[model samples]
Target: MRVGLYPGTFDPVTLGHIDIIERGLALVDRLVIGVAINRDKGPLFDLEERVAMIERECAAITARCGGEIVVHPFENLLIDCAREVGANVIVRGLRAVADFEYEFQMVGMNRALDASIETVFLMADARRQAIASKLVKEIARLGGDVSKFVPPMVKNELLKKFA
Candidate 1:
């Protein structure tokens, strides 16, 4: 069974993230969405909130994709999280040249940590490539409608947060 780990802060799950999860599911028997507690990123939502939001959003996608989707929240190193979940492959979504360059370096370091684990990169869909969590937060903060960028639940949460 090929298990893939897709790790991200997912402060609030966005459409672009769902796109990657759907695409990543195609290559592995099971795709685990590892929601990491990235202190460096200063997430707007708490760990539990992020986990609940992702679980709520991904339920349908997991059913329709014909594969298992596990939304697990973790702490510490990503490589350690992958190992804990028994993931042999790591799924990364590359939005542009800069993303590729950054991911390339991370993959090298991951490989050095564990040669047995492999990294897979999927290009973001053109429509959603520009969507990012930080931008979504900024737009919401400034009273812009982010209903299209994020799930309805997240949009509501963002509104309440700003309200």
Candidate 2:
């Protein structure tokens, strides 16, 4: 079966992320959502909390998508995580030109690590393109409502954490 890896910090998975994952699920037999641990950009939610939040959000989509998606957390190199999961493809979401440039570089690096792994970019829904975890967190921390950007579980967690 063809497996694809979708790796990201997922500080808090957004609806844009869900849209890409849902759309990407159609292209591969199996998709593993890899929640990477990034030490450079400190996250508001810890890895465990971020993983749980992603799991809850992805569970519904996985069920609706016929259970071809799996959510997992990894604290290693993305290519290593992809290899571990037996993935031949890396799925990414493209929001803008800037994203494309950044992802293109990362894709090249990943390809250098594993020549067999290919990167696939899915454009984010126009409306959701502007929504990102970092922006959401910033807004929530300042007492702005982010109910529309993130899942309910994530929204609650953000509120609790920021409150």
Cα deviation of 83, candidate 1, in Å: 1.0
Per-prediction count of colliding residue pairs? Answer: 0, 0
Model 2 clash pairs are: none
For candidate 2, which ten residues in a row score worst on lDDT? 63-72
Clash list (residue pairs), candidate 1: none
Candidate 2: which stretches are off by over 4 Å?
Answer: none
Most lDDT-accurate candidate: 1
- Pick out the ten consecutive residues of candidate 1 with the lowest summed lDDT: 57-66
lDDT of 1 by residue, 39-151 (tens): 88889999998999999878978778778899988887889999999999999998889898889999999999999999999989999989989999999999999998998
State which candidate has the highest TM-score: 1
Residue 36 C-alpha lDDT in model 1: 92
- Which regions in candidate 1 have their CA more than 4 angstroms from the true location? none
